[model samples]
Target: MIRSTLFFALALTSFSALSQSTLQDSTHIDLQPVSVKVYFAPQSLMSITSSTQVVGPKTLTAQGSQTLVSALNTVPGIRMEERSPGSYRLAMRGSLIRSPFGIRNTKIYVDDFALTDAGGNTYLNLLDPLGIQSIHVLKGPDGSLFGANSGGVIRIQPKGFDALENQVQLQVTGGSYGLFQEQLSVQRKVSDRYQFSFDHSFLRSDGYRENTALNKKTLQTSHQWQVSKIQQLRLFALYTDLKYNTPGGLTLSQYEANPRAARPAAGKIPGAAEQQAGIYNKTLFGGLSNALQLTESLSHHIALYGSYTDFKNPFITNFEKRIERNLGVRTYFSYAKPEAAMPWQMQLGYEGALGWNKIDNYDNLAGVAGKQQAMDNLDNRQWNLFYRAQVELLKNWNLEGSLGLNKNSIHYKQRFPEVNNPTGDIKFDAVWMPRMATSYQLNRLMALRASIAKGYSAPTLAEVRSSNRSINTDLAAERGTNYEIGYKFKTANNRFIADLAAYTYTMKDGIVRALDENGAEFFSNAGEMKQRGLELGTWLTLLEPRNFGFVRELTVQAALAYNHYRFGDYRVANKDYSKNKITAVPDWVNTNVVHLEFPQKLTLHLFHNYTSSLPLDDGNTVFAKKYNVLQAKLNWNTTLTKNTAINLFFGADNIFNEKYSLGNDINAFGGRYFNAAPMRNYYAGVRFDLK
Candidate 1:
């Protein structure tokens, strides 16, 4: 695999070199300045003193539209994995030790709404790729403004805010393994003050392995209205019905025998196929945001949102049902004095959430719910107050600082033959998080930055009440501090762009996952961890765009992440595993992308990923092998009429047919850790746009 990856890298380098020579006299790449909103305000990328990456439409379209795993992996310091067709897991600047299924320890936002609930869980899989316009990733802990999170933050911008034209679009797609998808979208502008967009999509697939099928439907809409010259209102809504099968993990011997087979019956336990092991989720979410400019230099913004979810899971061990509801509000005030001798800005904000969860667990009798085993009702509340300020001095130096105070508590009542009828509220002590950063513009093409921040994350509801059917009141929250330095550079002609960053994070009382003899999972606090890493990104434009030339444009981009993570002061049950490598964290990862545009409006996109091996257990007794994956796509776009356009695209994934496990079950009791990913697959699609 390493040899193959090296050869592929060298080939691409040679091709890029040839193209650069051939187009030596062509105009330099005409790149544009980029901006981000991680600070609740727009800031130039070149001047921000933080590690951030942005992904736009071109990056999303380079791969298949089925999932965001491949596209998101192209960014350094990020890892996205899929266990099956619809199950996803995300990690940034940290190991995936605490999360076995969903997203945790990270904050996420869509438009003006917080997707991460009060329980610290995000349903990222329920979102359709077509509904997303762009993504901005903030690496490392940023709890000063975004609340409790130790991993990172992801902000998603929905589709409607990108344009203001009235239009209609339809798309149809089909692929191997009985995959089918359809999407429809419409946007209308009633007047200059109001506009709205609506989108609907359906997707289904017969997965590569048995008992791994998927079906999903989505509906989404967004509206923007300028009520007055100094006021604006925005509303967003989304609904998704998603269902997917879960193929249980396999032992080494079972995996070697037949990688495509689902987990078979072990001893007297039932198999996944017989028990109908899968997930069924139905959710509805809506939010309204208002912005009012009270004075020339003062403004206020507020958002109100609510969501409900009906979730069900039938596994070999038990059948679980949950009814969850969440409500939240976010409001902030800002003051700016840019025209003063010394420009400055200040913002103050508050975010809070209230959540209720009713959970029931029952025996699984041939895909049916049987005798109740456990039941619990939990009420959770969390809130954060934050303040940020920025100042400019000496015409080239910028200084910034922020702080947040957070508090969380949960109360629960147990039913169904419960020993404890009611449990007192478990309250976590208030914590303070602070951040300081500085940036200096050395020249027109170079910048230098440094920052230090603190992060804190409380235990989620899932961790508090795990599958072991016990409430672990002793579980402690994790805390960490990160120090980072970065540099940014670009050429005068905008043909080359490069960014480099290095950081070290020290965390105490880190949460880790464990399993019982029956395969039920639990969580506990470990001793400590020391994580150090470096990230690099480079983009070069070989050929500029020209309508009269045969070769319209060509560009190549590469990103790399290197990690040296290790356990410190760690000891568990007579085991002294200190100084061992962290579990499920690779030593290095690299991704590359190439885009070429030809005459006749034809384009080709190529993607490659190489990941190094990593340990699967805390003791470093088992390891997963390294692997490489390659994908490609070809698209042809043309104008069918003066008011209409058509686009046709075909793509293939895993072009080399590498056998690997996308998501591994950590610390399994019986060495059932391997979940095989799909082999080579192909897909084709057509789209039409009407204006």
Candidate 2:
């Protein structure tokens, strides 16, 4: 009763504030200094050569997904695969291919933090929907801004400024699969050069399947102080704590039986070598960041970031419990000037990680986690440099170019009886990725654009994961080149925008997973791969934000994409395998959203998402059926007093409950996919503010 009452009162306060507060329009048709201040790097977005997209924070709020990756699905030409309940694989512009378990071809960044996975893929462990301010995707060799990313990059920007001169906001949510969340934020800035703010949240989920539950907590703080009459410094820090369970991958047959099912084979380790087992996982990660400015146009930024991560499963399918650990660091730099027509900003950085991995084999027959051996240890290091310049050429024409260089070093020590060989090596390779693009602004509302670049990815330790339990690393770096042409049209003053781009890429030396000499699946650098596609996306505002009338405020967005994959010759098991669609990649991915605001504090939203069927694995032998999802929501605000108002909102996912699944267990051993999508679910929430 107490909790409910507190929430009721809190909701009223926030609702009242919302009623009187003003909502900014991101669609304002002006390229003013204030408008550009928000983007960490605006040049990257305005230039045609880089091929970039920025998903506004308001859009994220409307979607209400738990993670940013979930919202990115609406972006065209980017492919995302749900490797696990909380884990996903991202590939941009046909660059995603087979990579080690912990590594990915694309790099992910949060401000100055590296945040990449232990295996090299960007880590989503700390991602939360409400904490983000905006998301930017850089396609093709972004070596100029982010280091070591050959395919592309995902950049997450956290919310900086908040409404209310001084206030406290709190919220709680409960949903399907025993999911629950608690969020709190305290901020104030009445006077310039003297202000502070903080936000924190806790989240937990029972999960959709066995052993998939998760509990997470995060906190962020920012403080600004004037050091001198003309200089100021801002300091910030962020922390994330996560504890969860991994149920392990399921077979096609097993998945078909139930989406929430778990393998009976993983319990061995905890049971003294039982085949099927599970474990609770824990992780602690955070970073310390800073920004300094002597003048409005001349400022400096720096960050020191690190993370301690461990995954422990003492008992399971192959053998018993296996533990892996990793810790790493990242550093960054930035520079920009608005006065110069050819504004430029360059960044340099590095990351180093030391990890430990060990496993055992109980019953080597089924290859179900049955291995026991102490592999020596692993030490990994990487370094990178990138630069990009936005040059305003002739009238209404702009050009941007970027370049990057990166290298890696790794070492592995043998610990078990069958694998006593230890090895280490340093690989020095420079990647040259440049994007030359130009946009011809025909008028205040129209423009033409085009650009091209190259990309490359290095092999990871897991690719060579050959031991008694798992496979060893034995693959080389994969490299490719990208080609794209596009056009942009905007209404006078930039109130409405539409973008279309067509891209094609040819790549060789693709690194992929395949059965090696041991007849076990592992990473291998293969022959060649290709992908071509077209992307059409648009954004429009029918009415300004917070408008109090039917159609007084509304925004609509839509996109359509088509990707084609071609291969000269494909071979699996030394036999010819060619001309097959690349696995897990959909031929079509599309989405549309409509948001409406009305008088008396009423809002309605409708959204739809669609994706073509995808393959279970790289071979494309097994596939997931195509499907579309629809959702609708309604919110009402009521003012109880001058300082308070109440808002009630309700929504549902998969309105039809149309049963589907992305699971592919059928193609395995000549089988078929068993489950594809989770069952339908409902959601409701209330948020409160105090001052």
Candidate 3:
């Protein structure tokens, strides 16, 4: 399969080159670079001092619309995994070590609102891929601006906010494993001062593994009104109902025997299928943002957001239910002096959040809630005061500095068993995080940058109140410092672009995951971790749009990441694991993609991924094998009329059918680590658009 795919790719490249040579005199197709708002300000890629990457709409649509896993993995230094149809795990650098299922240690924002709750957990799975317009990833840690985080930061931009014309779109899709999806979107601009958009999506699938099924529905709306010449108001709301079966992880022997089998009964324990292990999450989120231009050089922006979640899980050992509510506010003020001899800008901001959760655990009797086991109520509050300043000191030199003071505390009360019913509160001392960066423009097409930042992450509510039903007040937060240098280059014609970055991060009191005898999970602080890595990305536009040839456009993009992650002075129980390889982090990861556009409004996309083997346990006794994957997609677009259009697409994933685990349960109690991914699958879809 690899040989055939590579041969086909080569043949297409040769054809594209020949076709491009014939149309050398054709009209030039300008490929414009996009600006990013990662730092609360718009700037070109090369002008930023941090290591960041932006995934645009074209890249997001290149893969299937069912999930963002494949598209996000294309970015260097980032990894996204899907254990099932609707379950997602994400990592920046090597942060996946602490995440067993959902997203943690990372701060996430949807537009100007904080998507991450006060408990330091993000429900990334609740957002549908059809509603996402783009994703911006800040690779390392930058707590100086966003807040407390040791892993990194992610900013998600929803669709319809950029629509300037009235439009309606409808799409339907069907795929292997009984997969089906439908989506609808409507956008309208009422005069020149107001605009609104609505999007809805539904997806379902009978997954490949036994007892693994998924169903999800999502609704999102965005509205913007220019209240006056100096003020604007924006409103956003989202609702999602997501449910997916958890097949549970398999032991190596069990995985080898039957990769498609759900966890089987061991001893007196029930199997996943028998227990009907699964997750049900229903969430509603809303936010209101206001931007004001008080003066020519001063502006103010503020956002208030709230969310409610009803979460349920039925597992082999227990049934868990949670009712969670969260409220937050983010506000900032900016002042710029662009016309001054030495241009400079500054921002002052504050972010605060409050969350309340009521958790209940009961015995799982054949997928039903039985006798009550444990119950707890938790309240969490966090706040950050941050300031950032930017200055153009010299002709082509830029300097930036930022600082943030953060405070976190949690109050918990147990209400179930008398022995565990302890009323207590944990308050962390306030910490100061600072960052400094500098960038120099060597020329119009080349730039050099360097930065140093501090990182700190408090324990999440789940980690504090673990599956053991005990409050771990002694668990300390993770702290780290990162130093980085980067270089970027792009051709004047925008035909070639490349970014290279290297960083060394040293973290102490690192949090690690462990499982109890019952296969329940918990967290603890380890000694320290030392991580060093290099990332490189390049893009080449071989041919642009042409009117006369079969090959209208051709582009090639590739990303590579190399990691050297190791434990420092780490000892657990009777084992001294100093200098051991970090669990769940590979040494080498790479992705290559090819895109080709042809006549008849047809397009083809090919993707390949390679990941090296890595340790599965801190002791370095077990390892997950290396793997490669291949995927492809084809699309045909045509105009039906002056105000209407249609698009048809077909796609396939895991074309090589390689056996691998998309997510691994590291440091599992019984070595039940492997979560087998699906084999080859195919999907087809059609979309209709009215303008």
Candidate 4:
């Protein structure tokens, strides 16, 4: 399999080289400056002091990524995994020890509106890749500005409503494992001051493992109105209906024997196939945002958002149902002066969220609800106030600082099997976080930076009221401090760029997940843990457009990360795990991408990824094997006429056919840790645009 994959890659490279040799030269295309808005204020990527990455439409289209994991896997100090279709978890400069199913300890936002609930859970899978125009990722703890996150922040920006002309587009894709997708989009310029855009997508797949199937539909719309010369109003809405089956994890022996088999029946518990374990979700979300230019050098912005969700899950032991509602508001004020000798900027903001949930549990009898077991009502609230300032200390030096105050609380009331202490509440104390950073530009091509920051993260509601039907009143919030230094460099012509960073953090009261005999999950606070790592990223332009025959452009990008994480002081069941390697955190990760572009808008991409083996459990008694994967993509775009265009794309993943676990069940019972990823897959798609 490895040999075949290598041969295929070589053939593609050779073919592209031959074509380049026979073609004529074209005009050179200069790289544009990339800007991001999530960093307190809009700034170029190279000017940020923190370790950050930005992905725009060009990169997204080149990769032909179907999920967020594929789009972000090449980023340094970050890892995204999919245990099964519609199930994902993300880890940034840390380990996934606390996240068993969804994203945790991370803050997510969409154009100044919060995507994370008050309970600190983010449903990132609900958004379709086509609807997003760009994504910004801030690596490491950033609680000082984003609030209540130890794994950093992610801000997604959707396609804008403004359009130079009215247009419509349609796209269709199909691939292995019965994969199919369809998308439709429309943009309209209703008037000089009003514009809107709408998008809808449908996707389905018959997965590789038994009981693993996915079906999802998404609808999104955005509208913008220029209320006045100095004011603007924007509205955003989204709806999603998603359903997917869970194949469950398999033991190593079971995986070797039949990787496609579902989890077998255990004693009295039913098998995954019999129970039809899966999740069903229907959600509606909307937001209203406004920007007002209060004065020549001052601005004000505010946003109001709300969401409703109906969710259900049927598992081997039980069936669960939840109805949730969330409401939030965010407001900010900013002042800036760029023309003065000592230019400065200041921003102050407040964000708050309220959530209410009604949960019910019942016995699962062959994929059906049998007898009622428990019911509860949960209320959660969180608020944060933040202030940030940036000033120019000298012609080539800058100083930035931020501070935030956060408060979170939760209340629970039991309705079924009522007993003593049926109602309880937990309120965490208000926490303060502060950050200070400095950047020194030695020259136009290089910069040096350093920072120190504090971080805090509260336990999610799911961790307090666990799947085992137990309330963990002893759980506490996690707190830590991080220190870092970084260096950035870019060539004069922007032909080469490099970023390097190193950091270390020590955290107390670290949350960890555990499973019981029946496969029910729960959480507990570990004593302490420490993490240290180095991250490096570089991009080199090997061939310039007009200077290299038919090759419009050729670039190579690479990222490498090294992590050393361990338990400082921890014990489970009277056994000390201190000095043990952190669970599910690879010691080293490397990713490389090769991009080639030719005349007539033809593009080709090759990707290679490697991950080192690491421990799978707290005790370090089990480990997952390391693996490498190679992928390739090709795309061609053409203009049929002045008002029509077409694009075609084809891609293949895991071309080596290596059998590896995309996501592992950490600290699983009965050694059921392996969930095999797809071996080899291929996809092709075409799109049409009309104006």
Work out the TM-score per prediction. Answer: 0.96, 0.82, 0.96, 0.94
Compose the digit string of candidate 1's lDDT tens values, residues 1-691: 4744573465457445744564445666533246787887788888887988888777876888889988889788998888788999888888987784567778999987999998888999988887787888888898888888988899998877646568888989999888999988888888888889898999999888889999999999999998999999999999999999988888888877888888888899888999999999999998999999999899999999989999998888899899999999989999998888988999999999999999999998867899999998888999999999999885778899999999999888888666758666889898899999998889878999999999888999989988777878898888989999999987666677778999999989988887776668899988899999999877777677888777788877777899999999999999987999888899988888878899999999988888888888899998888888889999999999999999999999899898987788888789988888889999999999999
Worst lDDT run of 10 residues, candidate 3, spans 23-32
lDDT (CA) per prediction: 0.86, 0.58, 0.87, 0.83
Model 4's alpha-carbon lDDT is 0.83
- In model 2, where is the ten-residue run with the lowest total lDDT? 30-39
lDDT of 4 by residue, 296-394 (tens): 889999999999989888988999898989999999899999877898999899999999988889999888888989888899999999999998889
TM-score of 4: 0.94
Please give the lDDT score for candidate 2: 0.58
C-alpha-based local distance difference test score of model 1: 0.86
The true-versus-predicted C-alpha distance at residue 107 of model 4, in Å, is 0.5
Please provide, for model 2 over 120-195, each residue's C-alpha lDDT reduced to its tens digit, 9 standing for 90 to 100: 6444656566666667776665544555555678776665432325767676776777778887777778476667
- Evaluate residue 352 in candidate 4 and report its C-alpha lDDT on the 0 to 100 scale: 93
Clash number for candidate 3: 0
Ordered by lDDT, highest first, the candidates read: 3, 1, 4, 2
Candidate 1 displacement at residue 616 in angstroms: 1.0
